[model samples]
Target chain A: MSAPDRFAPLPVTDTPQERGDAARNRALLLDAARRLIAERGAGAVSTDDIAAAAGVGKGTLFRRFGSRAGLMVVLLDENEKAHQQAFMFGPPPLGPGAPPLERLIAYGRARLAFVHDHHALLSDAGRDPQTRFTGPSALHHTHVRVLLQSAGTTGDLDAQTTALSALLDADYVEHRLAEGATLDELGDAWETVAVKLCGR
Target chain B: MSAPDRFAPLPVTDTPQERGDAARNRALLLDAARRLIAERGAGAVSTDDIAAAAGVGKGTLFRRFGSRAGLMVVLLDENEKAHQQAFMFGPPPLGPGAPPLERLIAYGRARLAFVHDHHALLSDAGRDPQTRFTGPSALHHTHVRVLLQSAGTTGDLDAQTTALSALLDADYVEHRLAEGATLDELGDAWETVAVKLCGR
Candidate 1:
């Protein structure tokens, strides 16, 4: 199934009516933040460092993202959108062209990789229980549900989706990694689950 | 298989050498707290109410459990022990003597019930990521791993156990419940996962 409008990228919260210069500044700051975060880790990258890296003043950085925490959230959202694009529309396996079960396995591995790479930024985002089930999470749930249905798995799809998604949760993934499981091992384990659920 | 020493109840941290009367007071306070929490939700119950119900002064309640948060932790620990005893030592299905896969299914149902009944308290206790993988969580992992190994399941046991446990997490269960899934539906879905993993 093709990616539907409901699966659109997470809405960027910046004002829609911003001028061209403001939009450019926003993109520059986000790019700089992402680069700095990748280079020095999210915790080590300061707002000042991001502003200096973007060649913008500190005031512009704060105005763009509100606070350090806000910037981290936006960064996560941006990354989440890229990930959504990959599995929903990019190519075979993780995208639409592969078999349902294959796509499901690829999705788990890709999602795990995303979480592994963005662990610091994600952990720092603070999982607010109230907001955990909305937005990007809801989209992920829908995507998985569709795949599960497509795979011809019988039983309660909603419950299965929740169970599967729980395993892919960022915090749960981090907990497993901390407990000494490699990302590849986690991905393999998830594939086992996906295969089992598809009753192959 | 019998419950091992390692799966014993969570260690109660109260001073072991307390006077007989102090022990009595401690039990009284805990009983009162449990009764009050059952009658009124955990958030609605208070240390003062617990003290009054136990026919003790607030000072004794404080000295017994340290503080409100301390009392909640001890309460959760006590409940966790009872749950551990049931699955580890109690009879059949959830305990011993049942087929490994049946036991696994029963374990998931029992665990979902535990989290369902203690939803407010568990959520109130807060999920600290650092301590999440230790203590009771670790014990749960070992129990599930042992069950999988005994059932002759193939693939990564640790990873599989972690994935399974993630679905049974209190927060994830609560999230599903809030999203309109019934406890029975959750149990059924879990049974499906267990059956598939056991290759039944």
Candidate 2:
């Protein structure tokens, strides 16, 4: 889930009334967390490492985010929002001004790439189906539904979108990968399903 | 998984070397395990309950299945084999007597229903993607691959098969159900995907 909404609630750092120093401190820690996650993966980075990397004490880390998981969720949400914005408003097929069918295909490719890149954090955050489906996934589904409508397709768009979203599930993607299915194979299969459904 | 093969090497009782009494004792415990799982759900049932219900000692239960999780895996394997047999040999549509498209639709419905009925046990047994994707899922994928071939569709049948299988994944199905998608909705979506993929 990309929204801080589903994750154990946003940390105290997210409250609008935070002091300037506290806000900067929160940003510093989050920046450090994101860089460390990118470098070594989400599962490998610890709160202790994050605090050390951010040049802060562990107490400040805990005080701001409550726990390591909370920090990870918040940071992941940032990534999710960025992905959503890129597709919704950035440019080209993934953004606006492209054919709906093209956007749909682009969306699938981008989402598959997203899951592959951020699987560790996504898997850890999406412990429940609700969280897993509601946050970034819900946004993705709505995007697909709109694209399908714009593509001049008919029939239960709700169900269609849900079924389509199922293809990009992080756990499913990871499962396939763990079983030796390459990213290229997943992308090919996704293209097959997407093109068939879009009637292109 | 549909195979008893991947789940801890096919419990001791499955070997032909078992004496009549040992076979009977194994049957008793297994029957008890199934009953308890069906009645109260797998999560609520324990080894003690199965042992007591089967009129055996807890040690016998462990000796036969190794552990509680092991027992659940074996019990689930039994269900998977039954499902596999029903689809592979039993009757029209679901069995070998109908068109591949019809069989494919029937397979989706049967698998969805199977996951619904056994979610508790299957979820408990399949703690890893390796086990979940390798066993019964492998057989199901092969079944779908053959159906896709028979329907005369071309284009990476292996990858196409994998994508279609993702639509029926137990975790995906359960996730949709948890997110308020009804079984009917899931079935409809499956029909849409199957018919579209099969071009029937």
Candidate 3:
């Protein structure tokens, strides 16, 4: 069966009528939030700190992102979108113009790096099982499923996709890193699994 | 490095000096909780309902297990111990006598079934990332790591173990089931991945 058209760019849900300064304020808040989170960790960075750093009123922060969790979701979404764009469109291996097996290996490495880097934000954004498998995750599932199908992976495609995707989960990746495995070691292992699964 | 002696049976923390009637009451309450949870779902079954169904007072239930969350931990521990025993000491492929690759494959299948069966209880017991990588999860990691080492699998055994264990996670299993994949299909996919990783 053909894969569904699930890779269309995520919907741009921002209101179209927002004035220029409103958009600027939104960027300022997200930038400040990301910087604070990087310095102090997600839990330690409060909404008030984020607003003060952005030089905006706390009310502006709320008006832009609704709540602290909302800001987290948006921050995570931005990073996820950039990562998605690289894999979906940017260059060889991780994007296109490479053999399926090679692309698959590259995809795993790239995804491991992305999860490792954004572990804090991604973990804070969603732990709900219902939401875990939807949105960007659903798209990720489709991407891996299509790649496996192309590479002639013979068993259940959906299950294979789920298996691969699970390896890149933010929590799992963070746990491994904490246990003293380097990111390079993880990327190499992921490549090994990808090659084996692709029957290379 | 030798695998740590992490597979020793989990410590039995129950107070050994309890009276026979207290032991019976604890058993009664746990049985009732399990039955009610199986019938109406874990979320639907309340502490009051469990006490009422077990013919025990609400105070007795609290005195026995401390709180609803504590009861859930004990309930999940009971199931986990049984699973651990089966794999560690019970019989063959899932136990000891079989080849390492075959045992790994069997382990994955058995673990998938265990997660699928107990998804609700496990999902409710702990979603905290800190708690996730400890306790039973840590033991599982060691088990799979030892199996991979025995199988002579090359490159980053820890990462490979994490990859395999992540696939059998409760939330991942539940999400796949919700998406309509069968347990058998998951097992087959897991076996395929295990065989490939083991170089069979």
Candidate 4:
């Protein structure tokens, strides 16, 4: 008996308009959440409140986002993607155009800046342990791993990648923020550590 | 008038018997907890049940250990202090007599071993964020920081300490454990990283 192929392509649907509508609604929900968080706080904003604020029904809100944490996750996802894109493709040492080691240093700096700038959103979204541990996109890890490899780090690239991931772990970053460390200092320190980890 | 002295002698008392009693009770409570966790797991063991298992009243149990999380913390404290002592003063590469780098590596290995052996206790005790975050004795940040300093780590010791602490953060460690990495691998990898950070 031959093994079944799992690679059969499924029929594709042209759902451009549907996708656009979903995107718009997501923006509205996120905007509503931010407004609520700004006016009150992340803890003060519930799914029901977000739905009412967004002018959508609670059921629709749940259908779209699943839960309050899920909605917060979407907010974080939007910001994280934006940051990732900026670092991966946008400009300067953080973008595709820089020397590999320079890019690695810039990535850490940019990441520290991002975390500092969006402290509240990250904290609120990461309150759920499941979300904290696994909600981050694989791209985030991949992005750093690629940079480490490109930077010519010696000895066990996988271990270096894991160590780098630990550096970017949300809770650790948040703790530094809570300790009142400045973003610039964090960025500088990260550059130092990154250089050491990546070599002379 | 002279400038008043800012410090005063601590009021001291001999409480040897009281200390001994506390230690015995602590052992009893921890044993009860271990048994309960064995039978029903950490989630199922309540403070009341713990008190009953140890043949003590809930008030006595709470007085001795403030909450269920606190009780768990005390249990972990015993284990942590033991490990701390071993690294700080016990013998060989983990003790004061070894080369700084060797001691650092040994300390990491010992720490990993401790976590592996006390996995359930740490997990259970750390259920409450407040319990995990606060308390002078609970967070081992300072201990690790001191070790890094003594190991002759170059540059900003404070920053390196925080970065090193990030490496050992419980959430990250637990996540890695769940991802199927062995304790020995973690210990070895961390030994490498610690040596790098210590500029060995």
Candidate 5:
């Protein structure tokens, strides 16, 4: 397909084969990109490399994701969704089954682990301030708000939400880790904050 | 003196007249810069404008501050020192002699108020990430670390310090203000975090 035609097929009541072909191509591209990221890390993977690996033209890569940053965002979105699921429904201490205080602590620990696991992806997403503030992972805001509500905070919801923003400040995280703080310690302190702020 | 030569006088054994002149010039430049900042926020003020206002050549301004961002840092330092003092010695809840928990709460309230009062200064200093991170006013880190220690946290001091860093994250503060959070709410939350972390 031509560069322009890639986006042209959207929402079309078209032949099933074309749609199937497009879906297969997308999967191929995504799988190849994932392999590259796993092998060499996000910074090492280039769009040309992804295209070459997937056997698609450079135009196809551009058409799929507007830029390298956009691709990173996609990869991060998948990671975020999985993390969100783990917290929302997958297991104890992090999911719905644990006590509120424990859950809060568990949440922080899990989040730190996830951040460490996907350090490059998260950091890349954060480079663009606009994206960090407004991207769909804005689920971050929602997640904390819900947790605070669960913990019995009766204060202003907006303030609670803003406080959550601070929890994600990268410099603070970097400084803490650099200062020799461990994941367990951070998790415990967050649990303390969460318990105090939300009560019981 | 030329900009380079201006700094060359820093190591003098004794140059009373030069010292006096330098002092007077510094005062004049700072006064003029403050007036300009008050009349038109920090963004509107420039090195050239400050020099014109102070009736000094541009070289003098550059020589004195090193850069426009440095000038903002100095301006911010004055207010930062005063706020630091209040928490160190001012009054009940925020200053010396209060119960540690109450004092911690007061510190947050005081900081929130400080941010409100010096919103322009904070905004200006934040423009340069380097200044924001390394500026002299980062004494908040020290202050917070001391408070956490006094409050009886028994964990690794390094971890406690990291927790303190999270408490002072700038994004957290700005997010609170942007959400129209009241000074009381910020103070209350800070107190809550302090108490929880301190085991009070």
Candidate 6:
């Protein structure tokens, strides 16, 4: 399937009012799920708990997302879209205004932070290799590839992006943390390599 | 435990006469295990099959390696040591006596090849986060760190190694390939990052 089809955020329409309601509903459900997940954890939080917390019917929860896993994916996709917007349009150096190398460096920090914040849901996605490799990852690869090109990298851009993206895998980050690596070290390491790739 | 203690290879004594028999037995069993795994895959090949193929008793297999998992550990350790020695003392490029940047690039290529050759066994290891993170990976990170330092990398050397090693993770490599990445692309990408880190 196409990248957007696989990972695009809840489709926005031309109309603002209907989109607002849909957006609000999504936020409500996600906020409730996030609260329950934080209180207990991903494994313990259930569909019933989230729906009840959101003051929405169980049927609406199921209709909005087919299952618990589906809900988690939608939540993660929301984060992914926000990240895309941050890098694509938000502000420098993470957005379009900065130099290529600096933008790439900022992008790494932003992506790593996103992975850290959404650790529970994203790590759950890591358990399945297909889900881990698809959708949002495609967008990430494209983003990195564009940055590499804009930065005047001479090597195979595809490979560079793949290596960079691999570092952002939540499973790898979690594994590194459990292995005693600090978040500071993780971001620092990314900057070292990313700057190098940007020919700085 | 220290990194060396956690990920170190099986030690062989300096006295050939004393170590020869033990080493021979270990090699003999491993040879049989490799053949059996190649023929029927790691999961299908039983301990009994390895023992029978090696012309040793089942009791001996159990005595040498405590369990199936232990046997797998020993097998991986053998490969890990070869990798360590290659980058530490073998010859130019992959070994000592080459430019730091060359050695680092060679090391990345060698590590990728090792992961590919031992794909099944290592992929199995990826299922357990502790085993996956603490064992051979510690050695890999150390190896990469030393290379980065020797090549004059100034940023977060620790994080740089972590990111580089994550790209070589068997599960991640497999996922990338399943998502349509070629080994050539993967290696080329490593060279890009390694060379850049080396300030080439």
lDDT of each: 0.80, 0.77, 0.81, 0.70, 0.68, 0.75
The full ranking of all candidates by TM-score, starting with the best, is 3, 4, 1, 2, 6, 5
Give the per-residue lDDT digits (tens) of candidate 5, residues B99-154: 76667667767777777677666655654545655675456756776777888866
Per-model TM against the reference:
0.71, 0.70, 0.74, 0.73, 0.61, 0.65
**Candidate 6 lDDT by residue in tens digits, A42-91:** 76788899989998888777766656666787677866887788898998
lDDT for each residue of candidate 4 in B1-200, tens digit (9 for 90 to 100): 33453364432222455687676776687789878978986757888899899887788777677677777776677567777787767997887787777877777677766766666566656555466555423346666677778877776565665555544555557777777877777777787677788776
Candidate 2 displacement at residue A16 in angstroms:
5.4
Q: Which 10-residue span in candidate 6 chain A carries the lowest summed lDDT?
A: A10-19
Computed on C-alphas against the true complex, the DockQ of each candidate is 0.39, 0.30, 0.53, 0.25, 0.14, 0.40
Question: Please, what are the lDDT tens digits per residue for candidate 2 over residues A84-176?
Answer: 888999898788999988888788888888988888887666544335455555677789889988887655566566556666767778877
Say which prediction, candidate 2 or candidate 4, comes out ahead on TM-score.
4
Off by over 4 Å in 6: A1-36, A43-72, A171-189, B1-75, B171-186
Residues A1-200 of candidate 1: C-alpha lDDT, one tens digit per residue:
46696797755676678878989998999999888887888879888899999999999987876667667777788679888999999999899899999999999899988888888776656445544565466788899999998999888787667667766767778877887888888888888877877888
lDDT of 1 by residue, B1-200 (tens): 47696787665565677888889998999899899998989879878899999999999988876667667767888789989999999999989999888888899999999988887777655444544565466788899889988998887776667657766777779878888888898888887777777677
Tens digit per residue, CA lDDT, model 3, A1-200: 23554766554647677888999999999899989998998878888999999999999998987667667878888778889999899898889899877888889888988888877777766565545666567778888888889999877677667667777878778877887888888788877777767777
- Stretches of candidate 1 off by over 4 Å are A1-12, A15-72, A124-126, A178-180, B1-12, B15-72
Off by over 4 Å in 4: A1-32, A43-68, A165-180, B1-35, B43-71, B120-139, B177-180
Better candidate by DockQ, 2 or 5: 2
Between prediction 3 and prediction 4, the one with superior TM-score is 3
Which lDDT tens digits does candidate 2 get at residues B156-196?
67656766676675667787788798887777787777777
Clashing pairs in 6: A189-B159, A189-B160
Pairs of residues at least 3 apart in sequence or in different chains that clash in candidate 4: none
- What pairs collide in candidate 2? B1-B135, B1-B136, B2-B136
lDDT of 6: 0.75
By DockQ, the better pick of 3 and 4 is 3
Root-mean-square deviation per candidate: 7.9, 7.1, 6.7, 6.5, 9.6, 8.7
